[model samples]
Target: MEAAWVNILMLILILALIWVWKKFNSLWLTPKRLEKILREQGLRGSPYRFKVGDTKETLKMQMQAMSKPMNLFSNDIGPRVSPYDHYIVNKHGKNSFIWNGQKPRVTLTDPELIKDVFNKIYDFGKPNMGPNIRSLIPGLAMHEGEKWSMHRKIINPAFNLEK
Candidate 1:
Protein backbone atom coordinates (compact mmCIF):
# COMPACT_ATOMS: atom_id res chain seq x y z
CA MET A 1 0.00 0.00 0.00
CA GLU A 2 2.80 2.47 0.92
CA ALA A 3 4.73 1.72 -2.29
CA ALA A 4 1.58 2.22 -4.38
CA TRP A 5 0.88 5.58 -2.78
CA VAL A 6 4.44 6.80 -3.40
CA ASN A 7 4.26 5.74 -7.01
CA ILE A 8 0.98 7.58 -7.48
CA LEU A 9 2.38 10.76 -5.93
CA MET A 10 5.46 10.65 -8.15
CA LEU A 11 3.35 10.20 -11.24
CA ILE A 12 1.17 13.13 -10.36
CA LEU A 13 4.20 15.35 -9.77
CA ILE A 14 5.72 14.37 -13.09
CA LEU A 15 2.45 15.01 -14.88
CA ALA A 16 2.13 18.45 -13.29
CA LEU A 17 5.65 19.40 -14.36
CA ILE A 18 4.95 18.25 -17.89
CA TRP A 19 1.81 20.35 -17.98
CA VAL A 20 3.61 23.48 -16.80
CA TRP A 21 6.50 22.99 -19.22
CA LYS A 22 4.14 22.50 -22.14
CA LYS A 23 2.14 25.54 -21.17
CA PHE A 24 5.26 27.68 -20.85
CA ASN A 25 6.55 26.38 -24.17
CA SER A 26 3.32 27.00 -26.03
CA LEU A 27 3.25 30.60 -24.86
CA TRP A 28 6.89 31.54 -24.23
CA LEU A 29 9.04 29.06 -26.10
CA THR A 30 9.76 28.89 -29.80
CA PRO A 31 11.72 29.58 -32.84
CA LYS A 32 8.54 31.68 -32.94
CA ARG A 33 6.05 30.93 -35.68
CA LEU A 34 5.27 34.65 -35.49
CA GLU A 35 8.52 35.29 -37.39
CA LYS A 36 7.15 33.50 -40.44
CA ILE A 37 3.83 35.18 -40.00
CA LEU A 38 5.50 38.58 -40.12
CA ARG A 39 7.82 37.62 -42.96
CA GLU A 40 4.97 36.40 -45.15
CA GLN A 41 3.31 39.73 -44.52
CA GLY A 42 6.57 41.51 -45.58
CA LEU A 43 8.61 42.75 -42.62
CA ARG A 44 12.23 42.71 -41.41
CA GLY A 45 14.14 42.73 -38.12
CA SER A 46 16.71 41.04 -35.92
CA PRO A 47 17.06 37.32 -35.48
CA TYR A 48 15.41 35.88 -32.36
CA ARG A 49 17.42 34.66 -29.38
CA PHE A 50 16.65 31.28 -27.89
CA LYS A 51 15.63 30.56 -24.27
CA VAL A 52 16.66 33.33 -21.77
CA GLY A 53 15.48 35.72 -24.43
CA ASP A 54 16.46 39.36 -24.83
CA THR A 55 15.37 40.20 -21.32
CA LYS A 56 18.90 39.96 -19.95
CA GLU A 57 20.50 41.99 -22.71
CA THR A 58 17.75 44.56 -22.60
CA LEU A 59 18.11 44.89 -18.87
CA LYS A 60 21.86 45.22 -19.11
CA MET A 61 21.71 47.88 -21.76
CA GLN A 62 19.01 49.74 -19.86
CA MET A 63 21.00 49.70 -16.64
CA GLN A 64 24.13 50.81 -18.42
CA ALA A 65 22.29 53.67 -20.04
CA MET A 66 20.74 54.70 -16.79
CA SER A 67 24.08 54.77 -15.01
CA LYS A 68 25.14 57.69 -17.16
CA PRO A 69 23.75 61.20 -16.86
CA MET A 70 20.53 61.74 -18.77
CA ASN A 71 22.04 64.54 -20.84
CA LEU A 72 25.05 62.39 -21.65
CA PHE A 73 22.90 59.66 -23.23
CA SER A 74 22.34 60.89 -26.80
CA ASN A 75 26.06 61.55 -27.08
CA ASP A 76 27.28 58.42 -25.28
CA ILE A 77 24.82 55.82 -26.56
CA GLY A 78 24.37 57.39 -29.96
CA PRO A 79 20.76 58.50 -29.38
CA ARG A 80 19.64 55.17 -27.85
CA VAL A 81 21.47 53.57 -24.94
CA SER A 82 18.38 52.69 -22.97
CA PRO A 83 16.89 49.24 -23.42
CA TYR A 84 13.17 49.58 -24.09
CA ASP A 85 13.60 52.90 -25.86
CA HIS A 86 16.59 51.57 -27.76
CA TYR A 87 14.19 48.99 -29.13
CA ILE A 88 13.35 51.58 -31.75
CA VAL A 89 16.99 52.36 -32.47
CA ASN A 90 17.92 48.69 -32.17
CA LYS A 91 15.78 47.97 -35.17
CA HIS A 92 18.29 48.33 -37.99
CA GLY A 93 15.42 48.75 -40.39
CA LYS A 94 11.70 49.23 -40.52
CA ASN A 95 10.74 45.76 -39.23
CA SER A 96 12.39 43.54 -36.60
CA PHE A 97 11.96 40.87 -33.96
CA ILE A 98 12.63 41.40 -30.25
CA TRP A 99 12.92 38.31 -28.20
CA ASN A 100 10.90 38.14 -25.03
CA GLY A 101 13.04 35.31 -23.78
CA GLN A 102 12.77 32.36 -26.17
CA LYS A 103 9.59 33.83 -27.62
CA PRO A 104 9.88 35.91 -30.77
CA ARG A 105 7.50 38.86 -31.01
CA VAL A 106 6.71 40.50 -34.29
CA THR A 107 7.40 44.22 -34.37
CA LEU A 108 5.00 45.86 -36.80
CA THR A 109 6.05 49.41 -37.61
CA ASP A 110 2.81 50.20 -39.43
CA PRO A 111 0.63 48.19 -37.12
CA GLU A 112 -2.03 50.08 -35.29
CA LEU A 113 -2.68 47.63 -32.47
CA ILE A 114 -1.80 50.54 -30.22
CA LYS A 115 -4.65 52.73 -31.44
CA ASP A 116 -7.01 49.77 -31.48
CA VAL A 117 -6.02 49.08 -27.90
CA PHE A 118 -6.93 52.58 -26.71
CA ASN A 119 -10.01 52.78 -28.96
CA LYS A 120 -11.72 49.69 -27.54
CA ILE A 121 -9.50 49.27 -24.54
CA TYR A 122 -12.47 48.35 -22.39
CA ASP A 123 -13.10 45.22 -24.45
CA PHE A 124 -9.51 43.99 -24.27
CA GLY A 125 -8.26 41.79 -21.47
CA LYS A 126 -5.25 42.20 -19.23
CA PRO A 127 -2.07 40.88 -20.84
CA ASN A 128 -1.20 37.35 -19.85
CA MET A 129 1.84 37.41 -17.50
CA GLY A 130 2.22 33.67 -17.60
CA PRO A 131 1.24 31.27 -14.78
CA ASN A 132 1.76 32.69 -11.29
CA ILE A 133 4.23 35.34 -12.45
CA ARG A 134 2.95 37.90 -10.02
CA SER A 135 3.85 35.50 -7.26
CA LEU A 136 7.48 36.00 -8.23
CA ILE A 137 7.17 39.79 -8.02
CA PRO A 138 8.11 39.78 -4.32
CA GLY A 139 5.39 42.08 -3.20
CA LEU A 140 1.65 42.29 -2.53
CA ALA A 141 1.04 41.48 -6.20
CA MET A 142 1.50 37.84 -5.40
CA HIS A 143 -1.54 37.54 -3.17
CA GLU A 144 -4.50 35.64 -4.57
CA GLY A 145 -8.17 34.93 -3.74
CA GLU A 146 -9.73 37.52 -1.44
CA LYS A 147 -6.29 38.45 -0.19
CA TRP A 148 -5.30 39.86 -3.54
CA SER A 149 -8.36 42.04 -3.85
CA MET A 150 -7.79 43.35 -0.41
CA HIS A 151 -4.15 43.94 -1.14
CA ARG A 152 -5.02 45.92 -4.23
CA LYS A 153 -7.49 48.07 -2.36
CA ILE A 154 -5.06 48.74 0.47
CA ILE A 155 -2.19 49.63 -1.82
CA ASN A 156 -4.20 51.62 -4.36
CA PRO A 157 -3.72 54.96 -2.64
CA ALA A 158 -0.05 54.30 -1.99
CA PHE A 159 0.59 53.68 -5.66
CA ASN A 160 -1.28 56.78 -6.76
CA LEU A 161 1.34 59.11 -8.20
CA GLU A 162 -0.76 62.15 -7.53
CA LYS A 163 -1.01 61.31 -3.87
Candidate 2:
Protein backbone atom coordinates (compact mmCIF):
# COMPACT_ATOMS: atom_id res chain seq x y z
CA MET A 1 0.00 0.00 0.00
CA GLU A 2 2.81 2.47 0.92
CA ALA A 3 4.73 1.54 -2.26
CA ALA A 4 1.63 2.21 -4.35
CA TRP A 5 1.38 5.80 -2.91
CA VAL A 6 5.09 6.40 -3.59
CA ASN A 7 4.70 5.30 -7.22
CA ILE A 8 1.73 7.62 -7.68
CA LEU A 9 3.60 10.55 -6.15
CA MET A 10 6.60 9.93 -8.37
CA LEU A 11 4.40 9.78 -11.47
CA ILE A 12 2.69 13.08 -10.50
CA LEU A 13 6.05 14.78 -9.96
CA ILE A 14 7.32 13.61 -13.36
CA LEU A 15 4.17 14.91 -15.11
CA ALA A 16 4.43 18.28 -13.28
CA LEU A 17 8.09 18.65 -14.28
CA ILE A 18 7.31 17.87 -17.91
CA TRP A 19 4.46 20.41 -17.93
CA VAL A 20 6.69 23.14 -16.49
CA TRP A 21 9.51 22.35 -18.90
CA LYS A 22 7.18 22.52 -21.94
CA LYS A 23 5.43 25.66 -20.70
CA PHE A 24 8.51 27.82 -20.04
CA ASN A 25 11.02 26.25 -22.40
CA SER A 26 9.00 25.84 -25.62
CA LEU A 27 6.53 28.74 -25.31
CA TRP A 28 8.30 31.83 -23.98
CA LEU A 29 12.08 31.46 -23.52
CA THR A 30 13.15 30.07 -26.91
CA PRO A 31 16.03 32.28 -28.03
CA LYS A 32 16.74 30.42 -31.25
CA ARG A 33 13.07 30.23 -32.20
CA LEU A 34 12.58 33.97 -31.64
CA GLU A 35 15.78 34.70 -33.55
CA LYS A 36 14.44 32.68 -36.48
CA ILE A 37 11.06 34.46 -36.39
CA LEU A 38 12.72 37.89 -36.31
CA ARG A 39 15.13 36.97 -39.07
CA GLU A 40 12.24 35.76 -41.22
CA GLN A 41 10.32 38.99 -40.64
CA GLY A 42 13.46 41.02 -41.38
CA LEU A 43 13.28 42.54 -37.88
CA ARG A 44 16.45 44.40 -36.84
CA GLY A 45 17.58 44.69 -33.22
CA SER A 46 20.00 43.23 -30.70
CA PRO A 47 20.05 39.44 -30.42
CA TYR A 48 18.04 37.95 -27.54
CA ARG A 49 19.98 37.19 -24.31
CA PHE A 50 18.42 33.85 -23.28
CA LYS A 51 15.82 34.33 -20.50
CA VAL A 52 17.11 37.65 -19.09
CA GLY A 53 17.20 39.16 -22.60
CA ASP A 54 16.69 42.98 -22.57
CA THR A 55 15.19 43.26 -19.07
CA LYS A 56 18.52 43.71 -17.29
CA GLU A 57 19.78 46.25 -19.81
CA THR A 58 16.48 48.16 -19.77
CA LEU A 59 16.38 48.32 -15.96
CA LYS A 60 20.01 49.45 -15.74
CA MET A 61 19.37 52.13 -18.37
CA GLN A 62 16.20 53.21 -16.55
CA MET A 63 18.07 53.76 -13.25
CA GLN A 64 20.94 55.63 -14.94
CA ALA A 65 18.50 57.97 -16.77
CA MET A 66 16.05 58.40 -13.86
CA SER A 67 18.14 61.25 -12.38
CA LYS A 68 18.12 63.24 -15.62
CA PRO A 69 14.65 62.28 -16.91
CA MET A 70 14.31 65.61 -18.67
CA ASN A 71 17.21 64.89 -21.06
CA LEU A 72 15.92 61.44 -22.08
CA PHE A 73 13.58 62.72 -24.79
CA SER A 74 14.16 64.47 -28.09
CA ASN A 75 10.72 65.98 -28.80
CA ASP A 76 8.52 67.92 -26.39
CA ILE A 77 5.38 65.73 -26.61
CA GLY A 78 7.06 62.29 -26.64
CA PRO A 79 7.89 62.13 -22.91
CA ARG A 80 4.24 62.62 -21.89
CA VAL A 81 3.25 59.00 -22.71
CA SER A 82 5.34 57.16 -20.08
CA PRO A 83 8.81 57.12 -18.52
CA TYR A 84 9.69 53.86 -20.31
CA ASP A 85 8.95 55.45 -23.69
CA HIS A 86 11.94 57.70 -23.18
CA TYR A 87 14.17 54.70 -22.46
CA ILE A 88 12.78 52.94 -25.55
CA VAL A 89 13.12 56.00 -27.76
CA ASN A 90 16.69 56.66 -26.63
CA LYS A 91 17.64 53.25 -27.99
CA HIS A 92 15.27 52.53 -30.94
CA GLY A 93 15.68 55.77 -32.97
CA LYS A 94 11.86 56.43 -33.02
CA ASN A 95 11.26 53.32 -35.19
CA SER A 96 12.83 50.09 -33.93
CA PHE A 97 12.27 46.85 -32.04
CA ILE A 98 12.56 46.66 -28.20
CA TRP A 99 13.03 43.49 -26.20
CA ASN A 100 10.86 43.67 -23.10
CA GLY A 101 12.59 40.73 -21.34
CA GLN A 102 10.07 38.08 -22.42
CA LYS A 103 9.18 39.35 -25.89
CA PRO A 104 10.42 41.54 -28.73
CA ARG A 105 8.21 44.48 -29.78
CA VAL A 106 8.65 46.18 -33.13
CA THR A 107 7.56 49.76 -33.52
CA LEU A 108 6.20 50.15 -37.06
CA THR A 109 7.56 53.12 -38.95
CA ASP A 110 5.32 52.64 -41.98
CA PRO A 111 2.17 54.76 -41.69
CA GLU A 112 0.19 52.58 -44.11
CA LEU A 113 0.66 49.36 -42.10
CA ILE A 114 -0.17 51.13 -38.84
CA LYS A 115 -3.44 52.57 -40.13
CA ASP A 116 -4.42 49.29 -41.80
CA VAL A 117 -3.68 47.21 -38.71
CA PHE A 118 -5.56 49.60 -36.47
CA ASN A 119 -8.58 49.40 -38.81
CA LYS A 120 -8.48 45.60 -39.10
CA ILE A 121 -7.83 44.77 -35.42
CA TYR A 122 -10.92 42.57 -35.00
CA ASP A 123 -9.10 39.33 -35.93
CA PHE A 124 -7.30 39.13 -32.58
CA GLY A 125 -9.22 37.73 -29.62
CA LYS A 126 -9.29 39.30 -26.16
CA PRO A 127 -6.25 38.42 -24.06
CA ASN A 128 -6.43 35.82 -21.34
CA MET A 129 -5.78 37.46 -17.93
CA GLY A 130 -4.51 34.01 -16.77
CA PRO A 131 -5.41 32.08 -13.62
CA ASN A 132 -7.26 33.15 -10.47
CA ILE A 133 -5.86 31.70 -7.25
CA ARG A 134 -8.18 31.23 -4.25
CA SER A 135 -7.76 33.83 -1.51
CA LEU A 136 -7.88 33.40 2.30
CA ILE A 137 -10.61 36.06 2.72
CA PRO A 138 -13.28 34.53 4.96
CA GLY A 139 -16.78 35.38 3.73
CA LEU A 140 -19.68 34.30 1.51
CA ALA A 141 -17.37 35.23 -1.36
CA MET A 142 -15.09 32.41 -0.28
CA HIS A 143 -17.91 29.94 -0.93
CA GLU A 144 -18.78 30.68 -4.62
CA GLY A 145 -20.88 32.42 -7.44
CA GLU A 146 -23.86 34.68 -6.44
CA LYS A 147 -22.63 34.56 -2.84
CA TRP A 148 -19.34 36.05 -4.02
CA SER A 149 -21.18 38.75 -5.97
CA MET A 150 -23.30 39.73 -2.96
CA HIS A 151 -20.25 39.81 -0.70
CA ARG A 152 -18.33 41.88 -3.26
CA LYS A 153 -21.22 44.34 -3.56
CA ILE A 154 -21.52 44.71 0.24
CA ILE A 155 -17.75 45.24 0.54
CA ASN A 156 -17.77 47.81 -2.28
CA PRO A 157 -19.69 50.39 -0.22
CA ALA A 158 -17.33 49.91 2.73
CA PHE A 159 -14.35 50.71 0.49
CA ASN A 160 -15.99 53.53 -1.50
CA LEU A 161 -17.49 55.66 1.34
CA GLU A 162 -14.82 55.16 3.98
CA LYS A 163 -14.53 57.91 6.60
Candidate 3:
Protein backbone atom coordinates (compact mmCIF):
# COMPACT_ATOMS: atom_id res chain seq x y z
CA MET A 1 0.00 0.00 0.00
CA GLU A 2 2.84 2.44 0.92
CA ALA A 3 4.73 1.48 -2.29
CA ALA A 4 1.61 2.05 -4.37
CA TRP A 5 1.13 5.54 -2.88
CA VAL A 6 4.78 6.40 -3.57
CA ASN A 7 4.45 5.24 -7.18
CA ILE A 8 1.35 7.37 -7.72
CA LEU A 9 3.09 10.45 -6.25
CA MET A 10 6.10 9.91 -8.47
CA LEU A 11 3.86 9.66 -11.54
CA ILE A 12 2.10 12.92 -10.64
CA LEU A 13 5.46 14.67 -10.18
CA ILE A 14 6.63 13.43 -13.57
CA LEU A 15 3.47 14.70 -15.24
CA ALA A 16 3.82 18.10 -13.55
CA LEU A 17 7.40 18.41 -14.75
CA ILE A 18 6.35 17.57 -18.30
CA TRP A 19 3.60 20.23 -18.20
CA VAL A 20 6.03 22.87 -16.94
CA TRP A 21 8.56 22.00 -19.63
CA LYS A 22 5.89 22.34 -22.33
CA LYS A 23 4.74 25.69 -20.95
CA PHE A 24 8.30 27.02 -20.91
CA ASN A 25 8.98 25.77 -24.42
CA SER A 26 5.81 27.37 -25.80
CA LEU A 27 6.25 30.74 -24.03
CA TRP A 28 10.00 31.33 -24.43
CA LEU A 29 11.91 28.71 -26.37
CA THR A 30 9.55 28.72 -29.39
CA PRO A 31 9.68 32.49 -29.83
CA LYS A 32 13.47 32.57 -29.57
CA ARG A 33 13.76 29.72 -32.07
CA LEU A 34 11.38 31.49 -34.45
CA GLU A 35 13.31 34.76 -34.11
CA LYS A 36 16.53 32.94 -35.04
CA ILE A 37 14.85 31.33 -38.05
CA LEU A 38 13.43 34.66 -39.22
CA ARG A 39 16.81 36.40 -38.93
CA GLU A 40 18.54 33.59 -40.80
CA GLN A 41 15.99 34.03 -43.64
CA GLY A 42 17.22 37.66 -44.06
CA LEU A 43 14.22 39.15 -42.26
CA ARG A 44 15.34 42.03 -40.01
CA GLY A 45 13.39 43.60 -37.18
CA SER A 46 13.44 44.39 -33.45
CA PRO A 47 14.64 41.68 -31.08
CA TYR A 48 11.89 39.87 -29.23
CA ARG A 49 11.48 40.76 -25.56
CA PHE A 50 9.60 38.55 -23.12
CA LYS A 51 5.79 38.99 -22.88
CA VAL A 52 4.97 42.48 -24.31
CA GLY A 53 7.51 42.31 -27.20
CA ASP A 54 7.41 45.50 -29.39
CA THR A 55 3.96 46.67 -28.30
CA LYS A 56 5.39 49.37 -26.03
CA GLU A 57 7.62 50.74 -28.78
CA THR A 58 4.73 50.65 -31.26
CA LEU A 59 2.46 52.56 -28.86
CA LYS A 60 5.16 55.12 -28.18
CA MET A 61 5.74 55.73 -31.87
CA GLN A 62 2.00 56.07 -32.45
CA MET A 63 1.67 58.60 -29.62
CA GLN A 64 4.58 60.70 -30.93
CA ALA A 65 3.23 60.66 -34.47
CA MET A 66 -0.24 61.57 -33.29
CA SER A 67 1.09 64.51 -31.22
CA LYS A 68 2.67 66.07 -34.29
CA PRO A 69 0.20 67.74 -36.60
CA MET A 70 0.49 66.97 -40.33
CA ASN A 71 -0.54 69.19 -43.20
CA LEU A 72 -4.31 68.80 -43.69
CA PHE A 73 -4.01 68.57 -47.50
CA SER A 74 -1.23 65.93 -47.43
CA ASN A 75 -2.36 62.65 -49.00
CA ASP A 76 0.40 60.63 -47.33
CA ILE A 77 -1.22 59.43 -44.11
CA GLY A 78 0.70 56.16 -43.91
CA PRO A 79 3.44 57.69 -41.79
CA ARG A 80 0.95 59.17 -39.34
CA VAL A 81 -1.47 56.27 -39.19
CA SER A 82 1.20 53.57 -38.99
CA PRO A 83 4.12 55.32 -37.36
CA TYR A 84 5.73 52.12 -36.08
CA ASP A 85 5.36 50.46 -39.47
CA HIS A 86 6.94 53.46 -41.19
CA TYR A 87 9.81 53.47 -38.70
CA ILE A 88 10.42 49.72 -38.99
CA VAL A 89 10.42 49.79 -42.81
CA ASN A 90 12.83 52.73 -42.87
CA LYS A 91 15.08 51.38 -40.08
CA HIS A 92 15.02 47.71 -41.06
CA GLY A 93 14.32 47.13 -44.76
CA LYS A 94 10.82 46.78 -46.21
CA ASN A 95 10.81 43.02 -45.49
CA SER A 96 11.09 43.57 -41.75
CA PHE A 97 8.90 42.09 -39.02
CA ILE A 98 6.92 43.59 -36.12
CA TRP A 99 5.53 41.92 -33.02
CA ASN A 100 1.96 42.50 -31.94
CA GLY A 101 2.39 40.98 -28.47
CA GLN A 102 4.03 37.54 -28.95
CA LYS A 103 3.05 37.18 -32.60
CA PRO A 104 5.47 38.30 -35.31
CA ARG A 105 3.86 40.17 -38.19
CA VAL A 106 5.93 40.36 -41.37
CA THR A 107 5.62 43.59 -43.31
CA LEU A 108 5.10 42.78 -46.98
CA THR A 109 5.44 46.08 -48.86
CA ASP A 110 5.93 44.50 -52.31
CA PRO A 111 2.81 44.68 -54.48
CA GLU A 112 3.27 41.10 -55.72
CA LEU A 113 3.45 39.68 -52.19
CA ILE A 114 0.45 41.78 -51.14
CA LYS A 115 -1.59 40.47 -54.05
CA ASP A 116 -0.49 36.90 -53.34
CA VAL A 117 -1.44 37.24 -49.70
CA PHE A 118 -4.88 38.54 -50.65
CA ASN A 119 -5.34 35.70 -53.15
CA LYS A 120 -4.29 33.04 -50.64
CA ILE A 121 -6.22 34.32 -47.65
CA TYR A 122 -6.24 31.08 -45.65
CA ASP A 123 -2.45 30.80 -45.67
CA PHE A 124 -2.30 33.99 -43.62
CA GLY A 125 -5.26 33.98 -41.27
CA LYS A 126 -6.45 36.85 -39.09
CA PRO A 127 -4.82 37.42 -35.69
CA ASN A 128 -6.52 35.95 -32.64
CA MET A 129 -8.51 38.81 -31.22
CA GLY A 130 -9.76 38.72 -27.62
CA PRO A 131 -13.48 38.45 -26.88
CA ASN A 132 -13.73 42.06 -25.60
CA ILE A 133 -12.23 43.57 -28.77
CA ARG A 134 -14.26 41.23 -31.00
CA SER A 135 -17.48 42.25 -29.26
CA LEU A 136 -16.69 45.97 -29.51
CA ILE A 137 -16.90 45.91 -33.33
CA PRO A 138 -18.76 42.79 -34.50
CA GLY A 139 -18.80 42.38 -38.31
CA LEU A 140 -16.88 40.85 -41.23
CA ALA A 141 -13.65 42.37 -39.89
CA MET A 142 -13.89 40.29 -36.72
CA HIS A 143 -14.69 37.00 -38.47
CA GLU A 144 -12.37 34.39 -39.98
CA GLY A 145 -12.32 31.47 -42.46
CA GLU A 146 -15.66 30.45 -44.01
CA LYS A 147 -17.60 32.98 -41.90
CA TRP A 148 -15.52 35.84 -43.31
CA SER A 149 -15.95 34.46 -46.83
CA MET A 150 -19.70 34.18 -46.35
CA HIS A 151 -19.91 37.76 -45.03
CA ARG A 152 -17.82 39.09 -47.94
CA LYS A 153 -20.00 37.28 -50.47
CA ILE A 154 -23.15 38.75 -48.92
CA ILE A 155 -21.71 42.28 -48.79
CA ASN A 156 -19.94 42.35 -52.18
CA PRO A 157 -23.20 42.66 -54.19
CA ALA A 158 -24.12 45.80 -52.21
CA PHE A 159 -21.10 47.60 -53.73
CA ASN A 160 -21.45 46.28 -57.31
CA LEU A 161 -21.78 48.76 -60.21
CA GLU A 162 -25.01 47.17 -61.46
CA LYS A 163 -26.62 47.61 -58.06
**Could you report the Cα RMSD, in angstroms, for every candidate shown?**
10.3, 12.9, 5.2
Using lDDT as the measure, the top candidate is: 3
Whole-model lDDT, model 3:
0.83
Give stretches of model 1 more than 4 Å off: 1-31, 72-81, 87-90, 105-113, 116-125, 129-163
- Clash count, predicted structure 3: 0
Q: What lDDT tens digits, residue by residue, belong to model 1 across residues 19-113?
A: 99997667554456766676676666555555666777778877776676676434555444456635644664545566676566545444355
Cand. 2 TM to true fold: 0.52
TM of each candidate vs. truth? 0.45, 0.52, 0.70
For all candidates in order, the CA lDDT equals: 0.60, 0.60, 0.83
Residue-level lDDT of model 3, residues 1-163, one tens digit each, is: 9999999999999999999999888778888888999899889999988877899998998999999999899999989999999989999998889877676889877765665565566787766779999889888757877887787778766544477
- What ranking of all candidate models by lDDT puts the best one first? 3, 1, 2
Clashing pairs in 1: 44-95, 45-96, 53-101
